[model samples]
Target: MLPAIVLSVTIARPWREVYEAFWRPEAFPRWASGLSDMALRPDGDSWVGEGPDGAIRVFFTGHNDLGVMDHRVIPDGGAPVHVPLRIIANGEGAEVQLTLFRQPDMDDEMFARDRRWVRKDLATLKALAERG
Candidate 1:
């Protein structure tokens, strides 16, 4: 089993506010600037992202399951690591949990670096929720 490091934060914001912002794909570009741009298109029964990641085209899948599937998609070898997170409300503030899975033979340093990115991104999300 892959070990998952769970991180959480509490804010004085209502769950509804955060939930709406997260579900609407149109609002993603404003806060998460990692992607230059993104759009939601139908794929079978899912919404996938086809956007510009600087020079390369980034193809990503969106998960609407279990707490909005609050996550991002980055191309292989493009971004250090892309983790889809589950953002839920814990009392007053929202709780964002990132579950990291160990891909076979993946380098430790790479996972570490990806973990760092995920942390920063989560922090950014928290700040946005507080500000918005």
Candidate 2:
């Protein structure tokens, strides 16, 4: 297990609203640039999307009331990368946090790139959630 990189943002929305916006896999592409064209798999338990390398599959693990949005991203033929996401109450709004784990085999350059991507995605999510 490698150290986790955490990125967070405060959104001007209720915790539940923020969680709901991110709960749906289809909304991922709208905020996460690394993913696109997401669709439910035949099994209906996972989602398939076009990733930077190729097809990517994602499996989410959490409950609606828990505000936990942990998910596993499996790139084409690659091992799963676990991503932990959470939304918490912060004053009149909410704070969203995303944790990106560093893979043992990942180099500093790749890890930095992933960190930048996560930051951008979180910003996008905040903007989207606050737009309402």
Instruction: Compose the digit string of candidate 1's lDDT tens values, residues 1-132.
Output: 555566555655776667666656555555545543555554444334544444323333354544655444544355534455566777877776767665555688867865776567667777888888
| C-alpha local distance difference test of each model | 0.58, 0.83
Task: Judge candidate 2 at residue 104 and give its lDDT.
Answer: 86
Instruction: Give the true-structure RMSD of model 1.
Output: 4.7
Candidate 2 per-residue lDDT, tens place, 86-108, comes to: 98999989999988889988899
Q: What clash pairs does model 1 have?
A: 11-93, 70-85, 71-84
Best by lDDT: 2
Model 2 ranges with Cα > 4 A deviation? 37-43
Q: TM per model? A: 0.62, 0.90
